[model samples]
Target: MSSPLHTQPLAALRRQLLSRDISPADLLHSVEASIAQHDPAIGAYLQRDFPTALAEAHRADLSLPLGGIPIGIKDIINVKGQPLTCGSKMLAGKFISPYDATVITRLRAAGAIPFGKLNMDEFAMGSSTENSALQITRNPWDLTRVPGGSSGGSAAAVASGTAVATLGTDTGGSIRQPASFCGIVGLKPSYGRVSRYGCTAYASSLDQIGPMTRSVADAALLLQAIAGPDPADSTCRRDPVPDFSAALQGDIRGLRIGLPKEYFGDGIDPAVRAAVDRAITLLEAAGAELRPLSLPHSSSAIAAYYIIATAEASANLARFDGIRYGHRCDQPENLRDLYDRSRAEGFGPEVKRRIILGTYVLSSGYYDAYYRKAQKVRHLIRQDFAQAFAQVDVLLGPTCPTPAFKFGAHTSDPLQMYLADIYTIAANLAGLCGLSLPCGTTPPTAEAPALPIGLQWLAPPLGEATLLRAAAAAEQLLA
Candidate 1:
């Protein structure tokens, strides 16, 4: 039997289109068929407009790099005329984006079609896609397990062949953790590497938009299409986007990779450790050098990340009050009542918990004690990475503590859920580039199925070239 077109790598699909072996319409049909077959179980998409997507594909310019490719977008991103729900009832069915986000615009200009509104955590707040008010996104590999969040739907879609590639935002491991859980390549670019003008803010200082794909080369292609300085976003970097595709051609000979001692200490699953350790061994055998290093501040990453992220989320989400747009209280006893009722009715438990915590931390008496202290710790975390990068080309580690967990396993304990991203949050805090790709799988038991383990690597700001090169080499080695 022939493989599904949607299951093929983006580069292969693009080549077929260019050679007249497949048309954009054919690609769209393949994606639609996959969505029809798989999405009911995976719940990857919150909304899909295949009629419009097919129309766009029909007009796609095949000569363009991403031409005719359909990229699924996490719901938080603003795609003109599409729902921008952020997986919360707060904006669900209420807000339709009036303009394209810079990334969406760039994708269009590169001949890619933005096809679906993928599910996510409410306002990008949760560690599991379960926080999405709309639906639960299960790991494609295991129906009972969660695809990690807040980019879970993006990861699920890509893993399930519902999308050729997708866009996801990372604020404290949103992209990488999900990629790990879903067994795909998830790259979180440097904080300013991609414009955030159209993406809904989670943690302003840490949020970055990036690609989730089936392969490293596909990720490089998607990054090439969407990356560059954007004048609309003041926070976007002015640095020229490098040739990411070129980076993939290089080998990892003589590469210096640091394995932070703190990450290897404890709390990691034995299978996860073995899988990552094996990857490290492979890299070493391929002429790469491994050094044991310490990121002492890593222990405080979860704490600092929560404080700073929630603080920023609080400020950003305040705009959704029941007045101009989004969900609103039907009959307001008064202005305050409207605000209270709308927010209370709209937000889910996890989002409300975060907003409340954020509000308290930023409140008069606690600001200096919690929020300010967290920023200091964040800076220290960045310094730690700077110091480490000074000594090594990249840092290698597990993307998360374990493989994807069964749904409801960590739902009751938010702290346990938060710890799932222990290995990934620091990169966001430090403004470094990070990528996660599958290394190996755990041995399945009677109770659970075999699940993929992820190997992660981090690079300094704008060091995506190094990061991708290493990841591409690792991909080849692992394959």
Candidate 2:
């Protein structure tokens, strides 16, 4: 029989301490046991810190935010003294982070143990864990299917019970799609709400750190811990951070939700559409008004995201040329040869593919035609959201066109994977807050695997409080 420690929320685990039902060591033992027994095939954990984590858990005292909860960190974020590989062999055998990422610092303050780091797409470029420079992080639901990337391992960690919850970075649906795939909640706060100080950059403009957890409230608690300004990141916003958990209790009565016609167009799976419709019905029942709206420029969000994100990626990744940092080529006649050979050998096919595409788009002659046009399209897309928000307080849409697809399902074709993020990219472009929560499940089929559908609730910038309230309301109905 499973112990109470084996199957309960992190919050409940803390309550046991008050009643002396279980010592912190006993609780940590359960988590450590689960990870040891289950993670071999899953590959969710990139690195585990069991002894130190247990030591911290044992020392924790009094009412705490996370209350001795263990968590999984996406490999891109720096956790002082932990292996901070961004899922790449380029940085293999590397462990020299001098500072904690803002989120890690906050997690420690909240009494949460940073137990491990999880796998991700190399440099966070792919949609599935298949591209992880480390081992592939398999989905907890089907094992054969993908746990979406570049935050795949983080999602898989939470879903597989390796941790009660995990942190992920969303840059083009990385967080929400995996959450939808893994049957959990994922939030992407507005840009700057969460500090990006110690995070490795993929697409600086698009990347924002967020949380993945089993419940809306649990994700909310994680968000509270991580969302705030940090001096190291110049882009970190200084706006007042609201208490997300408290704000979730507010009434969403008369709240307006926009359903974009553009997102429901061709390529959207029928099952995904049905699940989102069901979530919409739930919101309507919870006093949220719904209306069909048009984000005409949204159709171009994919093209824009690719150009902008890849351009930023190309620049950010230039540092990995392997002279002062990372893996250097063994047989090099000179400096240029060493730089060329190191990057060429270290970067995976997908990583090379994007760098080439981005370089081409941002090159001298094509810059105005491709990169500049995409930026203009980005403005139009942002305008669409701004105009729509004038009429509707928030937006509702499918988190992904489908769910936990087969491992190689969208990999053969790059366009297919890019299209999967069509519905979620505009929020990032507009710098708005959004979240994905379990809505309904699609029945299994030979062609389509069984997976949870997520309803994406998006609000204007700095609107996380309202976003969670709406998500919780929809979640309550879906439940």
The top-ranked prediction according to TM-score is 1
lDDT of each: 0.93, 0.85
| TM-score of decoy 1 | 0.99
Q: Show pairs that collide, candidate 1.
A: none
C-alpha RMSD values across all candidates: 0.8, 1.6
Q: How do the residues 1-479 of candidate 2 rate in per-residue lDDT, one tens digit apiece?
A: 65436457656776786677877677778878888888897899888888898888888763777767777888889989877778888886755677899899898888888888899998888888788877988988888889888789988878787777889999988898888888889999999999998899889988999999888888888899888888888999999899988977877789988888987888878988998887777678777888899988887899999999988888889988778778888989998999889999888888888988889999999999999999999999899989998998888888888877888888889888888787888888889988988888888878656777788889999989889988887777888
Q: Which prediction has the highest lDDT against the true structure?
A: 1
Task: Assess the local accuracy of residue 303 in candidate 1 as a C-alpha lDDT between 0 and 100.
Answer: 98
In model 2, the number of clashes is: 0
